[model samples]
Target: MENMRSENHRGAAMEGVKLASEAAANTNRRALRDIKNILGAPHQPQAVSKRGLQEKPAAAGAKSQPSAVGHRPVTRKFAAILQQTQPANAPLAPIGSERQKRNADTAFNAPSDMECSKASDDDLDEMMTNELKEIDMEDTEEEEEEMPDIDSCDVGNSLAVVEYVDEIYSFYRRTEELSCVSPTYMAHQSDINEKMRGILIDWLIEVHYKLELLGETLFLTVNIIDRYLARENVARKKLQLVGVTAMLLACKYEEVSVPVVEDLILICDRAYSREDILDMERTIVDRLEFNMSVPTPYCFMRRFLKAAGSDKKLELLSFFLIELSLVDYKMLKFQPSMLAAAAIYTAQCTLNGCVSWSKCCELHTKYSEEQLMDCSRMMVELHRGAARGKLTGVHRKYSTFKYGCAAKSEPAAFLLDARRA
Candidate 1:
C-alpha cells in the first residue's frame, strides 16, 4: 500500500510540473507578441520544440502518459534566450543529431573575424561608390537647371558689369613708358618754326575732319610728326609731305576704316604722289625705330575726365584746351599725363566757374592744386593766344554745336589771368 501511494504522489508531482511549464511558456509568448507590436513588426507564432514532450495513450485509452521528469519543452524564443545566458561550457544542442553535427562543422570551418571584416569593407566601398554616383547625378541635374540660356538673353541692355580697369591702367602705363620724350629736344629745321608747325597742324586738323578719321588718329599723327622732327631735318617744301604721310600712317595705326593712299594724295591736291607718301611713311617709321606707340594727352584726358565725373560741356572745354595746346610747341615740354590733368583743372575752373581744383580731382589725378598751378596758367594763356591767332581749325571745330560750342565761351578774367607772370 505504501509503494502504491508513492507512485500516485510521483504522478501528481509530474502533473503539477507540466502545468507550471505550460503557464511559463504562455507568458513568454505574450511577452514576445508585445515586443513585436512595439517594434512595428508583424507577429509570427513561434514553433515550440516538443522533442521531449511526446504524448502516449495509457492502456485502454484511459489518459495521456506524462513526460519524463525534468524534461520541459521550450519555445524557439525561450530557447534563444536561454542559449545566450548559458555558460560557455554548457552544451546547447544534442551532439548526436545530424543538424547539430553540421552546425559544429560550419562553426569550426568558418572564416576568422579579420577575413569577415575585410569582406565587409569591400561591400561597404561598393555601396559608397553607388551612393556617390547617385549624388553626382543629382548635382549635374541642378547645374543644368541653373545655367542661363544664351539665345534668350538681352546682353546689350544688361546692367554694366565690373571691368578690369587695372588692365587698362597697365596698358596706358606701358605706353607712357615707351613714349617718353626728352624735354631738351629741339628740332634742327630752320624752316619748321613753331608758327609753321602750327599752320601744318591746323591743316592736319582740317584734313582729319574731312576724312572723318578718329580723334586718336589726329593725336597720333601729331605725335609722329613731332617725334620725327626732333630727330630729322627736312626742307619746308617736304614738311607738308611729311605731315601728309604721317597722317596716312596714323590712320593705318588707329583707324578702323583707314583712308586709301589715293584719297590722301587727292586731299593733298596731288601735292604728294602715292609713291612720295609711301616713301616718306617708310622713312619716318625707320627714323623712329618703329616706335609709333606714342602716348597722347587725349589718352590721359579720358582717364582724368572719368575721374572728374565730367559732363559733356566740361569734356568739350577740356578737349578744346588740349587742342589749343597742340598748336603750341612749348607745351611739348610737359608729359602727356600732366598736360591732361592741367587741361581738366583749367576746364573745371573756367566752365563750371569753380574757384580752384577740388579734392576729388587731386585724389584721382594725383596732382595737387599747387602742382597744376603753372601748367593750368600755361593752358589758359594758350587759349587766349589761340583766340587772337589766325590758326582757327581747332577754334572753328570747338565753336560748332558738335563740340557744344565750348570755344565760344570763355572763363572768368580773374580765373584765366590768375597767377600769370
Candidate 2:
C-alpha cells in the first residue's frame, strides 16, 4: 500500500510540472503578441515547431495546451532571469545554464528584432534622401543668387549702352560667324605661308604701336588681311604692301586721327609710295565689299572686361595675352568672342595664381572654362615663348612700364598640368 502511494505522488508531481510549463508558454506568447503590436508589425499567431508536445491520457487532456509550444524553453529563460531579481535566498543560476537561457531568449526575440531593424533601416534611408534633396535645392538657389547682375551698375552711363548693349552683343555674336576665316586657309595660298603671315603680323604690331593707334585698328587690319587673303592670292612681294594697306584701311575705319598715307610710306622706310598704298586700299575695299563694320576680338574684350569687373592690372594682362595670340596663325581657328573670353580667363588665372571663373563671367561670356580651355591653352603657350622668340613685338610692348609690364607676369603653368592629366 505504501509503494502505491509513492507512485501516485510521483505522477502528481509530473502533472504539476507539465501544467506549469504550459502556463509559462502561454504567458510568453501573449508577451510576444504585445511586442509585435508595439513595433507596428501585423499580429501573427505563434507557430508550433516540428518538435511539438505529444498527446497524453484523456485525464491529462482535460487540461489546456498552450497556444504556442515553441516558447516553453523561452519561458524557462524568463523564469531564470526573474528569479535573479528576487532575494539571494535562491542559488545563483549556473554560468552554463545562464548561457543557455540567454540563447533561448534570443531565439524567441529574433523575428521581432529583425522586423524592428528593417523598419529602422528604411526610416534612416528615407531621412538621408530627404536631407540630400534639401542640400541640393539649397545649392541651386545659392548659385542663382550668386550670379551677378553686372549690367545694373552701368545703367547710368550712356557709353555703357545699357539699353542696347545686350542686343548689340547679340548682333556681334551672330555676325562673328561671317567674320571667321579658315585656320587652314594658309594651305590654299601660293606665295604666302604661315611663317610669313606671322612675320607680317609681327611687323604690323610694331607699326600699330609706333603710330599710337587704337587696339581695334590693329585687329581690323589683321581681319582685313586674313579675309582678303582667304579669298584672293597675292605674290610674296606684295604681302607687306597688303599688310600696310590693311592697316591704312583699319586706321580710316577705327581711328579718330587717321595716319596719312605718306606717314605709312615713311614708316615702311620708303618701301612703297603713296600710289602703291592708295591702289592696294581700293582693291581691298572693293574685294571685301566695304564690310568694315565686322566685330573684332577688341569688341568682345571691352564687353568681357566689364563683365569681369576688371581693374587696370587685369585689363593690361588680358590685352597682353590676346596680343600674343594675335601673332600665332593657328589662333585664327578661334572666334573673336572666344579669343576675348579666353584671354581674360587666362589672364585672371595668371594674376590670381589659380583657376578662377566666376559665375558672372560664365553667364555673360556664354562659354564655360571647358569651352575656353583649348583657346586658353594656346594663349598660355604663346605667353611662355613671348619673351624669347623673334616675334617678340607683343612681349616688348607689354613689358613697358606704361602698360604696367603685364608681360613680366609668370604664365599659368597649372593649365599645362591639366592637359597632361
**Highest-TM-score candidate:** 2
| Residue clash pairs of candidate 2 | none
What lDDT is reached at residue 49 by model 1?
A: 42
Q: TM-scores, in order shown?
A: 0.59, 0.66
Question: Which whole-number lDDT from 0 to 100 does residue 145 have in model 1?
Answer: 54
- Per-residue lDDT of 1-30 in model 1, one digit per residue for the tens? 999999999999999978877987888653
Mark the regions of model 1 whose C-alpha exceeds 4 Å error after superposition: 1-163, 174-177
For lDDT, the strongest prediction is: 2
State the lDDT of candidate 2 residue by residue for 21-62, as single tens digits.
788788864433354321222354665445533333234447
Deviation from truth (RMSD, Å), model 1: 17.4
Residue 238 alpha-carbon offset, candidate 1, angstroms: 0.8
Shift in Å, residue 289, candidate 1: 1.8
lDDT of 1 at 21: 74
Cα RMSD, model 2? 16.1
